[model samples]
Structure formats: C-alpha cells, structure tokens
Target chain A: MQKILNDKLVVTADIVLRIILYLSIVASIFFLGKMLLGPVLGITEYKSGLKTPIEFSVNEQGTATFGSNQTVPVNIEHAKGLFQIDRPVPKTLMVVFFLLNLIFFGLILWVIHSLWMIVQSVRQKNPFIVLNGRRLHIIAFSMIGIELIQGLANLIKMLYLEPRLNFETIIVHSKIHVSIHVIIAGLVILVIAEAFRIGVELKEEHHFTV
Target chain B: MSIRINLDVMMARRKISLGELAEQVGITQANLSILKTEKAKAVRFTTLEAVCRVLDCQPGDILEFIADEKNENE
Candidate 1:
C-alpha cells in the first residue's frame, strides 16, 4: 500500500493541504487588517451574510416582504416560510460577528495545519512520530472547539438582535444549534489519536529492541 | 534501566574492536555500539549467543542487573 500510494496520492494530498493552510493564513491576516482599518476609514456599516431561524407570517398569497424591501419568493412546496437572510448590521455587531468568523477560520486552519503535518510525515515515511499523535489530538480538539464557537456565536447574535431589529413579517428565533455529527467526528479523531500514540510507542519499542 | 550491558567490559577483556566484533557477530557496528553503551532495550538470544561465541564468555559476563533505588523503594 505504501509503495503504491505514498509516491503520488499522499504527496499530492500534502501539497494541497499545505496550499490551503497558507491561503487561509493569508486570508486571516487580510481579514484582521480590514477589520482594524475599516472603522478608521469611516466605514461603520457591517455588511455580511447570516443564517438564522425565523418565525414568519405570510399574506393571502403566501408571500412575505422582508425588512430590506425585498420580496422573498415563496417556494411552491413550502409556501409559508423563507430561509435566506441578508442584512446590514451595526458596527459593534459586525465586529463581534467578524471576530467569530475569524476564530472559526482560524480553527479550520489549525485542523488543516495538523492534517498537513501528518501527511508530510507520511510522505517522509515516518508517520509514527510521537508529535503526529499530538497533532491529531489538536485536530480533534479544534474540531470540537469550532462547533462550540459556532453554536455560541449563533446564540449570541440571535439574542443580541432579537429586540433591536424590527421586521415587517418575520421574527428571528433565538435558537442555539450544534451539529452532532461534527462532535462525533471530533470524538472519533480523539480515539484515533490515542491509537496513533500507542502505535508510536510500539514503534519505539521495536526500534530499541535490537 | 536495572539491566546493564557489560559488552564493553567483555570486549575489553577479549581485546576485540567494535567493528571486528560486529562483523564476526553478523551485526552492524552501530547496533554493537548501542549494546556496548547500554542503550539497547533488549538483546535477542541469537545476538547474545553470537557475542558469547565470539568473546568466549558466558552471557552473564556481558549482562548485569543492578537494582535501582526507585525500584527498591517501590
């Protein structure tokens, strides 16, 4: 397996992940610079996209006019509700929202960085290094942390905007949601990290068994 | 480790160089150096037999066990 896959597939994967890691780092730096400079440049309106739960009341034709003077096209299958949200928020809310997104991006970059290191180790034919196990543990924890921040950010945004924003036919619901599959994936990675640690120990034992 | 390798002592007594002994024992000089310096985790019976045959000494002449204070306390 190593003979066939190690030369092409693993190297390609390592390169791809490395590229993504570098790009994400650059993007994060750009985002931070923009956030820091935007207010100083007299740009206070925070224009961004968000998805949230809503309580909607449709008219006789089963269509609603959103706060932004836009008509939401009601689907024939689900004529009573609309899912998409687009709004310009306050500067403070934008700062919090952008910070949360930046943190989420950072966590994703962390997972990518760890994955790239592990793949690089495999490319070098030394995947059982003790540090690789720690990298896997980092990836696992970062995954869980990403989900937690997502849920918390969503809840905070919902609660903060609940009383302030006035919509014509829709009310945003303050609901906190987390993806169970992502948490389960984090737990699985943790188990894999433990197994990798044990494998590294066994490899060390074999190395010194001369 | 409690188990100590006395390979250097045995080699000295036999007047055998590391390269010469390693070649005679069909092992690498680096591995022989590890064994001589007590850095090895375990010795195979084959390697021990070859070392003994080359040095004309028993296995006990090359390996010694000194009880650790930590182990004694435990």
Candidate 2:
C-alpha cells in the first residue's frame, strides 16, 4: 500500500494575509510604545502641558516648535521656548500645528482600515482575497504610507520649526530624541516590507491529475 | 487535511529510484526527499505535473483516501 502526507497548500491567501495583518498590528503597538516611552519614563517632559510633557521654545525670530512627548520643566529666559506663538497670531499658529499633525494622521486611519479588513475576511472565511481587492491594496499601501508620513512629518516640522524652536535648554534635548524617532520609523518600514513579501509571493497550486 | 499521498507504493509499482524521479522532475534530491518523506509544507502544481509525467501515472494512483482506522473505530 502507498502512503504519503497531505499537501493541500493549507496556508490559504486569507490566512497569510491575516497573519501579516496581525503581525503589522503588533509591530505598530511596539512602535507606539517606543515612541512614547521617553515621556513615560520621565526622561523628557512636555513643557506646555503635564499630559504631553514636551517643552516648546521659540527662536530669536519668534517661532517655536514642539518635539515628541517629554516632560522636562521650562525655563524661558526672556520667554523663548520649543514653540514660538506670536502673541498677535497665536491662533493661526495653533491651527498650523493641528493641521500638520492631522495631515500625517491619515496613515493611522489606513492602519485601522487594514486591520478592519482582516477581521472581515476572517469572519467571512474567504480563502483568498478577491483579485485586486481594495482591502489588499489598502493594507500594502497604508503600511508604506505610514512610514512615509512619519518621516515626512518630522522633516516638515524640522524645516519649518527647528531653527525657531531652541530645545537646547531642555534637559532631554532634541538630539538624542530625534535619532530614536528615526530608528522606530525605520522598523515600521521593515515590517511593511515583510508584509508585501508575504502578500505578493504566495501562489496557488492545483492538486493531482493523471 | 484528510488527503494522503502514496508515493512509496507508486514508486514500488514503477520500480524507479527516488534519485531517478528527482532527476526526471529536475528538482533537487533533498526537495524530492522532503516530498517522498511527507515533510514538505507545499507541493507546486508544476512539481505535481512533473511527478505525474515522470511516473506515467495519475495523481490518484499515487495518492489515496483510506477511511482512517480511527474514524472507522469511532
């Protein structure tokens, strides 16, 4: 009698995508934790509010910028900080910060979208995503978009606010924090690359014919 | 999950060495070994196509579904 083990490509595309989606989510949580750790650890402080702990200070030209959350106390010599709010136009400047942060915010929306799609697939028990499904592409593009947004947001803030915002006075100054920010962003990109690898490479096989 | 592969019996029936099959299939002996030993995670359609061509037999000849003894007892 002949004997062999079953090989039915048990790993369906749905299962693969589900695994990748969950893996990405786990990586994202790690990212958020790493980004927020400094403030939680009391290594840095947000000067503006106790909740954020990031110190904002303005440069000689009267513009200030904010950094990732840290809670070192503020000492404004003649009142200059990480973010400079011109008394005359402080409302307009606040709006800019809100927009800048929110614009990059879409990446978070994309992440949520991908996770939701995975859950739907799981519930429906779809074996493989429909060819060119919107969810599949969103998962891929959203992850890539998240990395791009984080990197670009930092650059935008730096170009617009860095010179005007002097973080030199803060005990946990910008230098050490900025590098960690980049490293965490890089890890997110690496995970995104792995997701694409798993998604696009797997192929279906048909079982035996004479 | 319930499917089984019966390469061993087919090989015996055909009287061909695993090495010969590997050569005919143009796959590495190690990979062929994995398939023969049931350690393979997956089998490609091309590989299945190759196996059928080399053996001159249908896949059904090499794979079978005996109602499991455990299932029968139950």
Best by TM-score: 1
Docking class of 2: incorrect
Write model 2 residue lDDT over B1-74, tens digit each, in one string: 45677887888889999899889989887778777776565778798889999999997876666787789899
Q: Write the per-residue lDDT of candidate 1 for residues A107-193, one digit (tens) a residue.
A: 898899899989988888888999999999999999999999989886876687656667785544455668889999999999999
In terms of lDDT, the poorest run of 10 residues in model 1 chain A is A76-85
Evaluate chain B of model 2: give its TM-score.
0.79
> Backbone collision count in every prediction?
0, 27
Candidate 1 runs further than 4 Å off: A1-6, A39-102
The true-versus-predicted C-alpha distance at residue A108 of model 2, in Å, is 1.4
Grade the docking of candidate 1: medium
The DockQ of each candidate is: 0.70, 0.03
Estimate, for each residue in A1-210, the C-alpha lDDT of model 2 and write its tens digit: 122121222335446666766676676566444434322333343221111113343333333445866445444434322442332223343344444444445455565556566555545555254432445455556555555655555554555455554445433222212444444654565565466445533522221111
